[model samples]
Target: MNVTETKRKVEINDLYKLSTAYDAQLSPDGKSAVYVVRKINEETAQYVSNLYVVDLETKEERQWTFGEHLHQTPTFSPDGAMLAFVSNRTKTNQIYLLPVNGGEAKQLTFFHKGASNPIWSPDGNMLLCSAGVKSGETIHTKEEQNEKKELQPLVVDRLIYKADGRGFIKDTYSQIALIHIDSGESVQLTQGDHSYAASCWSPDGTAVVYSANLSDDPDAVFTSDLYVYNIDSKETVNLTTGQGSFGRASWSPDGSYLAFLGSQEENQTVTTTKIWLYDFSAQKMHCITQEWDVDVEDVGVGDLHSWRRNPGLIWTADSEGFYFLMSDQGNVGVYHGTVEGELTPVLFENLHVYDLSVHSNGQQAVVGISTPTLPGELYTLNLTSGDREQITHLHDTFLDDVVLAGAESFTIKASDGWDLQCWLMKPAGYEEGEKYPLILEIHGGPHMMYGNTFVHEFQTLTASGYGVLYINPRGSKGYGQVFADAVRGDYGGKDYQDLMDAVDYVIREYDFVDEMRLGVTGGSYGGFMTNWIVGQTDRFKAAVTQRSISNWISFYGVSDIGYFFTEREIKSDLYDNIEALWKHSPLRLADKVNTPLLILHGELDYRCPIEQGEQLFNALKRKGKETRFIRFPEATHDLSRSGDPKLRLDRLTYIRDWFHQYV
Candidate 1:
């Protein structure tokens, strides 16, 4: 086929056709790897994830398990004889097992709140998982209550009584449980008012390491201490001693040490996640990445697969060190870290390694990588030589007909003398001498980076004949802790100038960008910046803000994270610095916004509640300014990334149409 013939514009609906790979787990022999590939069912408009296995030797791949429901968290048995995964096919999500060689999956558990994160015991005769149940109730009783016909009023008691996606916080607490494979019997391991996080299976199979606050008031404390629970003795021992928030536990091959990722800082959200090693002999914890400036996980946010979880701490066979993904600058790379605080780059490239799995021999590794042009795919790599071979052709057929824009990364010095990293994606089918409208895109997280990853929204904007400009402003991770923390107390100060300077750099340097037809858009922190940008200047013709924060005063009480996030990030308290909070609030300057703005928010978004959008929309409308607000029902703060498939598409459509209408 000719070059132009291969370049077809990517459509919004193409989101349904793209397949995403996640969580690759290598077998004990390292000859095979199984991972979850998620795709949208066009007919049902729902995301369905199924297990897929790949032969590492011949590079042959096949679907290992299939069902209409979501299948995820695939883990290999100790003997590599069976594969256990969590599936929602049953009435509730439960553990299911399928023989490695070949067989139908057998449902293993029937817990009321379902089971997840299945880890097989060393003996391969049992599995350990977590399931939510009432504080003092049995699974059967809870299931029976759920199956009851009569309706009852919901009683709220806990300080944290509600979550964004989950409307009301039920009394159920996630507990650790052990399930026998042969007898189909399950035993509860730990139970309390507190919920347990994911755990690591001890090498000898006698214990499991888990994390929980276990505090008298969990909502009042930010500590998540690691604990070891003896399966035989049923005794729990605290490992972290409530020093800091810690989780993502990984046991050494010989069980001499346990490694996890966390921070001991008081300002938890702004603190960088570093690797911590707990020595069994000394009974002490050491921060292995204390000198390392990078964030020790995949925090480079994206829309296509924001639900994607980091591979966590993957231990090498010898237990001398481990391989982990660290966010530095604009890339998340796999790094080999020694127990002695040394980090060696293994796969440090202009790519996002979201998840990875190393072989038992530590010679071969499977990685989930995404680039600006590539959505996401699984690739097998030779750890010694760093040679990678793409093993899956999931979206090959679909991407063949898609025309992706060329992304160029550049660095510009902000007015405050900080080097800001930015990327510019040219519009698809660009001609040599033609000028196109540009959309200045800001990423949420003010802490998240606009890295070298595939962002579907940016692609969709480029496909619609717009150049996309995205920058990693201050307060954005990957650029050292200092640069990331720079915006904590100065939200609209230097960070705002970094974005403006990035836009000016592109407009001044790039000849093909139309200066008159400028557009701006972002979600969350990006949304907050978009609101601030239009208020500060009317250079952009239009702007779209999603799940944005408008008023810090009200946000302190209304947002799920309002109380602390406001005090921590903004460095302002409602009682003392109420005026300062209002000063930085975008809603305070709403009367100055002249650019046609569109506010999109999730109705159930507790992170940045819909009230934030409502306030902005009301302010602009009451002033007779051009503005619009669109709310996605039952959608949470993750609407752009993991919300309903249709709603995500509609949100993209709204963004494209809004920019088209003004810019």
Candidate 2:
């Protein structure tokens, strides 16, 4: 018998035992690779990450750093002698240098606001990093900022004044700076009211290419332009005409071309992101993936993976082609693309490739992948021979002792004749003829796709005798642009029918599913759908809506992304179409809800603020509907994914208990 058969099912606290490996980086010489592994410290209820290096030739792994703090963004020097990374070991994030041979790591930056995204210069004598600084404030030590602690009222004037995880936006802007590695001396590069990101030094180390919005009214404009900043002359030149949002600029190996991923639609959120290349010699820019209908970024949604960075475009030695990640048909995979618009599959599979790094020759690559059974691990891929090998066994032993339900993928036509990809996970100990409770899970980001990735919550639900069902509905990504943008302006219309059709198909096809004991739960956009579903039909016995929006009229003014997202999604503003917004709101149909609904929300979630949940709860209470509200204090929109460890466990417990009681 299999060891998993003798072992136990997955528990809620099993989250603490899981480990995630991401941010894989290949050495310059391609002999070895380094990555970061993160795990939860149960005592502190926080995540601690450490750097690890593995020899490609010997297949031996060694731990490079040890601590309770985060050590991420590990990049090797030009000559592959030392590694530069960002760490918060001193209570503030700063740049640190470690020698590959052997020695104590050295601290490099002392900016008061903290520094991140460390990039080594080509000559290895300097490092380019980013830190926050007020327009008129000079660089100061951390001690100076600690001395001032006066409470002041925040004054807001910009249109984009706040964010979800981050609170009120201050006057500080993220600026780029150059730090000399030997003396630790720093010089501010680009400084103004605007912010810069995805900055990298030119091959010759004389200039930098970065993404920023330098328009007059940056708050109102949604365009991100690429600019080149010269170090010696202190002059800036605009690369892109500022028609769209672009970033992740990467220079080719020969420094003749620049490749990046972006969308040309100014403020539209559903436009497909494509790869664009800039020719330095010709001073021209063109889209490389114009014919391809896939999004050039990872859109897979999962709770366990945290801090997964996008490895934009890794160039080959020839500078004529590069490798990139694309989301298509419910999976994110690596694809090879050339400047002439030829795209080939490099490692396309039914998995999530979250991070990637390629060798100088481009024949080998290190990819971070995750599946339904595996949380996350690093794998080495041979580009030429198409051979793949798992280099890290982080969860092998843990998985051997746990019975994880495998997902079965299928395609079904929606009510509107659209093909929808769906997955079903049977209960852990499902018998052939035994009827099991079914739970339909919805994903957030109405545009984000749910693929064959590991979700701890789904596993726990299946372990508790509930069959889990999930689908990438009409509004989800990984499909073409039309499918992703279809749900816009019609939230509860066709999208609602698509979800209902999925439930109907599953119940009719699978005799083991208990249709009468059905449950539905989703967060954000999924939360909205759950509320809408319960209000529309009484088929579901229990429903849980998390960080949901009930009233679009109020959501427009309350949520951080409410004003723009409402206009873009609902295609209506308060002044023009109040009735349309109200028609789509779940609270408008509160009197029709009969399901035992549980509302969960994060108090500090600005994206879908807590007020949205309170409004629904009050509406349901006024109508005497079966509803209960639970609020997590000090938690943000990221509560389900990267929140406090204890809170995450409590959340999973609450979800499981609610379903067990009602379903």
Candidate 3:
């Protein structure tokens, strides 16, 4: 068979062939750009990331780094002569400098605990990064020496001791470290029990600003304040005074103003992120987007696994205006804001901008965008004229050969009269009047919205001859704060009705849906809804729930954020409102569920512990309800997204086969 003539449906393994691009950083002159590209190596069953550079004028893209190194966080030096990035080829992640003109990369620092987040000073001679150090050890001591000690028992003394991906909390604190590019010498800048969350340098390079929560009970406070550290005097100045959960500080070009993103805890877990500015001359702080009514930062949803953090503020050369990505109405757009609190749309459209970098001149930008049909790619946009040109085509050949379904967006009224945004994607290669099975997909964060972004899981279901239906129900972001906050106290109330109404609208409008063969699935918050839906109704023929929460009473003290999350979302307490907590728990209603459900969970998931899944499974099995449980070993709560590559493919296969047999 000829290569182009052979047409095959998207298999579970095709995920390895797809590559993701993100985190674009433009050079000083605006003629070149560097970004991160990630692809799976099937032979090793690991994902590898490397830096790629492109000529903005000619639109030529080429890989800059090679070999087994997993390169990321690429940033150009202040003089644009060298590019610094973090790689893990030496068993631990460390910063490496690569000449812009093309030469062998040189490793900069060899810290004991590794290094990350390299920030260039104004002079480009010294670099600033953070590393974790032990309580009684300096940066020169080897962490491996302590690891070789006789198996000593771990003694826990703090309220927060363990994390999901990082395991148990050891006696290590992340302190800022300064490295000289010329001498390759590393010096510890700050020391204490607390860790610096993030940092940036001033224009003069004499002071470094960072955010940290230095309270006595840091874990219980849920607050971080900005602090400035002087290089010569080694003195520190508190900036924000521990007012809010603030970080991601950016310095203005003239060193007169500092900007950061944060929000006051109005609804706690449902608070919206906004931008705040601090003035050096007036020594005052103010909220710049207090009236914008939009969530600042990229909360866009996509099926691909992404580890890219939010970028710093893209300040203009004149330091009068800045650009950022904010979540709004089913899409993330880049917006421009003035230092005086004026906001305007710079690149508003139906798309998801994961990360971006603006030119120093503020005339153009390199953005990482993903839409419904595009997996992910890079584009250069003219800030002045609003013109966009594609820069990378990583999956062009594969996409052209395969037939895919496009999402059709629509709006409907919820049971409570609120407008709801929903989408339906027909099965690939659908014929007129041909009925197909349907799957209703829900997103993880009940706070996260399903919008104009590429969803690989949904596409896999579509390729398997199923129509996919998704909706931005109440409690989903992209709507106003009121709508997103409505589902806090009401878990299965209006939000449940909104999902059912979405299904009804689709069945009434589209005649190609097989109403009897309906399937449903979701993860995290969506998983809770799936558990709730199965208990409330027997309409869904089959269902799959991943990383779900079943019992709130036990969950209060078990999960990582269970203590505060229960207080905020469920509005209940273990000591005071045990009955109320049980009332909202899905395990309480497990006896009512008759739908065939396949419980998928990660054994190492601390957010919604594996015990939650076990409890639900045992409840259903004891009641003679059809249920099966499958657990992925050594996987975290993000198993579906960032887990082992082989395990992810197996999960897709399991999902497809379960629906195929039951639906």
Candidate 4:
């Protein structure tokens, strides 16, 4: 092969491909798979997702869904005769059935409430799906509503809940429903004035084991419990009764036992829950991998796997051994485990892994893998031999000419004496004795982690001729819970020290860093930290904060989950200790800031509303500090991840320009 072929890259417009890749589900026999393809066009300003099926043996592919309507979540019936999926072709998300052999699809349900999570019964006669309307909305027939109580204002108990991202105006409750294939009538499985979701049909198809916070205090929406609904007995049983978050419950294929994930109620610290398995015969429960050594990443253990199915737990064909995604060092990989505790590695990813789906045959799988230098693409993996093959070439062309930077790993001791692992990505063509601007990048979820994987933004920023330093710092996962929770009640205390220490260590050791031209940027919680950093110190020349929080007092009432998250993380209640919140608010120290700051926000961002951006920008402006704010109208909290492809590229360009201009 030519050298050019060896370095060949893919692009978004490649025929039969997409700019963004998403869910891929394999056929029962593992001989075929259908995946969702997302296309982004520069000319039409169009982005669309369509369904396509690939025949493994024949290498033949065909489009299964068409038209302007979007389709997703396609599943083949057990017998492999029909394809069932949820689509918005009719302008509402509804379930439809089509003969896989070939032909038009038949629309099933007709409720104005709409439907979601289309799961076919094992026998393929009845489809077990979750259908609902908006919570607290009056569910009345057209005639009844015309003659009865005009809709009253909906009152919600919880501080945070999900609003439908798309579909018709929802005015109903969320609940699990059973769709009769013949009659098309959806029977209310579990019903109440309260909301419930994330359900899976039991092994015997007689009931559904799901997680809910129905009885949980609305103000405190974190607690949940495992509840089973019996279709035959018309009974709902609280299996693992407690005020804990229990989720992703799956039944053993034999119906002899059930497996799920749960954490204790003792502390509010964010950590991975153990995989819990309960045997009906013994009426006892045991955690599959409770050791400090392992963490659950996906769903079931064996051949076919399912994660939390959008809402709750559901079992898979391979329940004999549990399989989960985990990270050790910087590597994230798949591991195999027996329900009794025997566990082994399947795939230790050298890059970030996503979209991992297993086949019932237990021999093959598909996943999206990325390294610090790579974007992401689908790859096929062989289970037995640990072999991997690239299945999709999504963006090779844009990357070919771009000389990407690779990660250089190192470590430093935090001021608190804790050893902190760190990594640096140098710009392409980096040379010794050349001074370079540096950007300290932090990740969000303070509970989430950044591992050894390909991050496009990291590469893109480096290519713009700057060194990027990313640190997990304290409160990051992968390390034990103690280390992860080190900054719990202390936001800018030790965790802030850990970050500054990393920068100090780098500045002391790396002569190429122009300390006077330093910059800092992060998103979400990272955004909060960025705002805090600029306010606390004027060491950095420039700063950028994305989806950030400025004032803790206002965040508690404005941002989604701000009501609960602030109380838990910031540990200051508005009415009880409003002073502490003011002290911790990044805006409080705005007077100390001299660095030029840029605030990027999404208008539809309920997670950390755009008001946070306005507050920070207004604060810096009032203090006579340089500040700018840009907002994406249709974007949400995922402005970086699932934002418009063109806009995502534009945001990266903006960040690069701001840093280059000031630093």
Candidate 5:
């Protein structure tokens, strides 16, 4: 099938359609546009995501690829004649090139492993991509051979053990690669056990800058250095030699400056998140957005009515300033930052913003917005008045035909008086004095936040006779750097308290919450919190921990980001306090857990690793406590959002079943 047809067959599972969004983009000339479409197939147990092109002038939309594959990372060529994207149509994800007008999509690279994050070269003839190596290829191949031959006598000795949904695994390692669009050849530009991840082409297209941690530390995961690779020499020169984790790098249009956001020092969890601009010629680093001492990321909600997430940062027409995301004053808004370091806020309010695109003219920007009462929709925003106009009517058909539950946003002070913000989704037919079963849904990203965006799980939970509560706990971002770091070195301390406090406030304030029949669920850090919560308190009758960290010691060596993340979050290395890591580990306290728990893990999860669940389940079983672990054989860390559609649905079903059995 062609590109447009591929997009047309994009069907989404009704249960969790809003888990992610298709972000639209405008071209340099603003004559045409690009957007992403996502679908989930339950029968196939897969997610179908692809890119589509539309001619704004002609009002035409077309797909770019076809077949049982996932396509993403679509970028426009400088001349706007070709589109570059990464696809797994060949079984392993790799870069593919296609014409914007339409034609047979050309396969650019053939790697035994998968590739991701494709960016067009300045000249548009070559595409830069990130390459990942299967952690234990030789052993894995042998496992496949043994399984096919009907033998089961392989040795099971490895530091990195079995992946829950996947088979025995070690880890995922990735470096940067450059694919030649015309020749269909690729070259590994960076090398080492220290993986180089993020990829971005310099504005001038002379160098490709990325984040890598080619560290001497054997288990170092977060020690990434900013480096520029010369395509001609196949050489990489390290830029930021300092010790810090750099994320999401973007170069200023002038190429003289490169920018990325990161914490400033080593072993610092609450370091101020600053936009650092490095001078290519001066070899110096200067910090931007100095006014606020808080951390910033995917910040700012432009409007609730539009649709999108992770609003893209666009440069002004003159390149004098950059327009991107910032959340301050308890709101998310677009802010324009000048070259000299003056930060100006453009849009603000209690809206969740994502997938932002700026018109070539620079006077206006378009974003996806969602409010408390609506599903996400696309909208065009006048950067000047904050006046926004709705664009596509995506879900009005389904929404108008069904009775939808409403979400209410409120803030309550924690025990320490730190203002904690939360979103409560009451059951559709919620009645006064009716005590409804409550599901305390926690978010991950110990650095992320709860927002006004529509969450399918929350709505579904509310529809299923449960009240859902999600809060931006202490470690959550948007509350300033201090509060975000407040949970550092004290993982289950204040963050747990904050979550429990919210539960208490909800039970006291809302008569609909059946506190005695409470259920808790979370992924990643939230998963870790759930595990910790069950260990510390039995308030929750049922608990589901998705891709959680049960033991920090095992986690530090097994997970893709475990090494640095462990130290970064715990404020110490594994040896620094192996006992502390264990003490802080939810598994260590598992003997105290009596809550009926459901452990949901992805077979391919690398972030928290599946052994987390293994350890927890084994402990619970030894204790003869009620617990069950369900492993999604082909899912990843994002089982709820990016995992197999069937598995995603099954995940909800399993949680509901487990809760139903216990609650």
Candidate 6:
């Protein structure tokens, strides 16, 4: 037998062995590249990340930092003599600098609220950083208050006070600061109740551009504006009007243009994000990708690559064009565009490009890619010739002895004749005539597309003798604007039909999929659909709802983004249109559910609060239905993807065991 026939199947513990490389940064001369490698510590049940550097000429790699804590975002200085990164080894994340020659890394900043997102200055003498500071506070303020052992009541004054990962908000605001490399002194540049994120520095180092919402009541408005802060004059100029959301600003080499990514429509969640250019001489802004139908951002969803960073927009050295990642047709790839509204594909492929770093010459770039069988790796691409060379072997050894199932892509017509993209993964070591159970996987973001990326969850299920089916229904990105907005008012209308059509198509075409042993599961919006599916039909033998929404009335107040997200996505509000909200809620039809459901939720998930799971479980129990509830403590909405390692494994085990019992 061949080596592939003798390989072992993937297991739940394989998550600890997978290493992901991200946040790639190329040096000024393009001789060396630095990226981050992240892996889980099986003993500690926590994540550990370190910096690694690879030489382009020799293709030799070496670890740059070693620690049990997290280290990320490695940026090279202008001279390429030193590297700056962020680490939490000192109890809080702070900037640290290391000389390329050799020595111990030195701490650069001591902000009490912590500092991150380091941007090197043009002259290489200073670093632009971001830190959280409360009102009337400076960057040098030291922590003096003792740790509280008792709980204190929180005072809420803003609609956007609480967040999913960060929990209850303190009055802290993220502000920009400057740190002197030699003197180790820090100066706060921006202040107020508002927060600011520094994007880039001008070529001459005279001004810096940042994004912030400066409205009197920022909670009421969802627009962000870019401003240029002049260093010597201490003056600020608003480059963008307060009508749209814009960020990720990149200055041209010639210093005559500024490029950014954003949408002109404020508070519209379904609108496509476009690329815009600001002309310095003309003092006007124009949309470059307005005619392009694709979304100018990476929107591919997967479980393996968490904390993946986007390169945003990288400018050419000649200031003639730029490079960016765009999502289209269930794939994210690199595209080149010029200042004169010219666009072309450079490296469009069947893989997801999650991170990118362009060389100063603009002819080469380093990208982090993930596919159906590959978790993640870094590759150097020749921008002109479209040639790729793998530079990282983080997963080569581990994958050699494993058998992974590849996804088969196809298109199916929905009931309304809308073409939808879908993928199916058969069980590993499958036979032609044998039947296997099938599981339908739904992605969150109802706005995010499920593309060609490695998902550990899907691999584990397939390894356990189950087929997996995933589809990009209406209201998902990578399609046009209208398709993405189709399910706004009609939550369970066409989107539901499209999903059902996909399942029917797979079962009819592939006789190996057992129609009687079907299962369904999803999180967030997908979770809501799982609940809806069980209530609408008894076809599915088992169902799993994760971080789901059952009642829109309570969700509108409890969820972090519920207040506005409900109004935008549901097209209704708690005060004016209570009936419309109730009409689309899955809890309204909870009495009709017949499938055995397993509800999973995080205790600290403020995005889709735990109450959503509680209400669904309670309703199903009152009806004397078959159901179970599993709650994870200290976990957020991303429990399946980025939660604690042990908890993530336990979740997968529970999901597999539940399906094994019922399906």
Q: What C-alpha lDDT values do all the predictions have?
A: 0.88, 0.90, 0.87, 0.71, 0.72, 0.93
lDDT tens digits by residue: candidate 4, 517-630 = 788999988999999998788898889899888888898887767867788787878898999898888989888888899889988888788898998888788989898899
Candidate 3 accuracy as TM-score: 0.97
List model 3 lDDT by residue over 1-663, tens digit each. 654346566778888988888878999888999999988888898989999999988888788999766899998998899999999989788899999998999999787778899999989999999787878887777756554568778898875777788777687888888999999888898787888865689889999999888988876788889988999999988989877878899999988899998877777888888899999999988998887777888877676736767876778889998888888888888999889998889887888887788987889998888888788888899999989998999989878767667899889987778999999999987889899999999887888888888888888999899999999999998887888899998888889999999999999889999999999999999999999999999999999998998888888888888888888898888888788889888899988998999999999998999999999999999999999999999999888888888999989999999999999
* lDDT comparing candidate 2 with the true structure: 0.90
Best by the TM-score measure: 6
Model 4 local distance difference test score: 0.71
Q: Name the runs in model 6 displaced over 4 angstroms.
A: 145-150
Two-way TM-score contest, 3 vs 6, winner: 6
Model 1 is weakest, by summed lDDT over 10 consecutive residues, at 139-148
Write the number of the candidate with greater lDDT, choosing between 3 and 6. Answer: 6
Evaluated against the true structure, the overall lDDT of model 6 is: 0.93
Judge candidate 2 at residue 263 and give its lDDT. Answer: 86
Write the residue-wise lDDT of candidate 2 on 478-571 in tens digits: 9988899999999989998989999999999999999989999999999999999999999999999998989999999988888889999999
* Model 4 weakest lDDT span, ten residues long: 299-308
Better of 5 and 6 by TM-score: 6
Best-to-worst ranking by lDDT: 6, 2, 1, 3, 5, 4
lDDT of 5 by residue, 95-130 (tens): 777787668788776666667777787788787777
1-663: candidate 6 lDDT, tens digit per residue? 778798999999999989889999998889889999999988898999999999999999989999798999899999999999999999899999999878999999999989999998899999999998977888888887878767778888899998999987778899999998999988889999999999999999988999999999887788899999998899999999885999999999899999998998732998899999999999999898888888999999999777887678899889999999999998999999999989999989899998889986889999988999999899999999999999999898789989999999999999889999999999998999999999999999889999989999999999999999999999999998988989898898889999999999999999999999999999999999999899899999999899999999899999999988999999999889999989999999889999999999999999999999999999999999999999999989999989989989989998999999999
Query: What TM-score number comes out for model 1?
Result: 0.97
Cα RMSD, each candidate: 1.6, 1.3, 1.9, 4.6, 6.4, 1.0
lDDT score of residue 515 within candidate 4 = 89
In model 2, where do residues sit more than 4 Å from their true spots? Answer: 1-4, 140-148
Candidate 1 residue-wise lDDT, 48-132, digit = tens = 9988888888988889877788899999988899999999988688999998877789999898788887988889999888888
lDDT of 1: 0.88
Q: Which of candidates 4 and 6 is the stronger one according to lDDT?
A: 6
